[model samples]
Target: MTTAPADATVRVRYFAGARAAAGIPEETIRLAAGATVRDLVAELGSRHGDGLTRVLTACSFLLDGISVRDHGITLVDGSGVDVLPPFAGG
Candidate 1:
């Protein structure tokens, strides 16, 4: 596993099913300087377990309030990431 740069941090916010799966509303995750959203998901999967992995596959992500579809997008330090699982009704 890659280690986080000393000064890099990503705040992850979980909503709905994601929150239920992670058992928390939010968490601060450390990452290497150039880590991507995919990396963050991998780390979270490792930390949280398979349930989160499954939930994540059906979720949408937002980076600092902007919707992000590419998991390869590099993350900015001290940015906030929101994990939004699908809602039953629009």
Candidate 2:
């Protein structure tokens, strides 16, 4: 197994369904320095349980205000990440 890097902090904002599932609007997460979005998702899943984990699978993320299309993208210290679950519209 690979070793995780040093810890780094990121601001995670949950919107709509994600917010409901996480039970919080936003939070700060401490993860490995080179952790990817995938890593963060897993961390969240392990913390929040099935409800949030389910929501997370369908959520999209914005890293520092830019859409994150790749889960492999590494996160840096003080970066901001938004978790947006699918929105129902008319």
Candidate 2: 10-residue stretch with minimal lDDT: 2-11
lDDT of 1 by residue, 14-59 (tens): 9999999999999999988888999999999899999999999999
What TM-score should be assigned to candidate 2?
0.90
Backbone-clash count (model 2): 0
- Candidate 2's C-alpha runs over 4 A off are 1-6
- TM per candidate comes to 0.90, 0.90
Instruction: Kindly report which residue pairs in candidate 1 clash with one another.
Output: none
lDDT of each: 0.93, 0.93
Q: Per-residue alpha-carbon lDDT of model 2 for 1-90, expressed as tens digits?
A: 987666779999999999999999999999977899999999999989999999999999999999999999999888899999988988
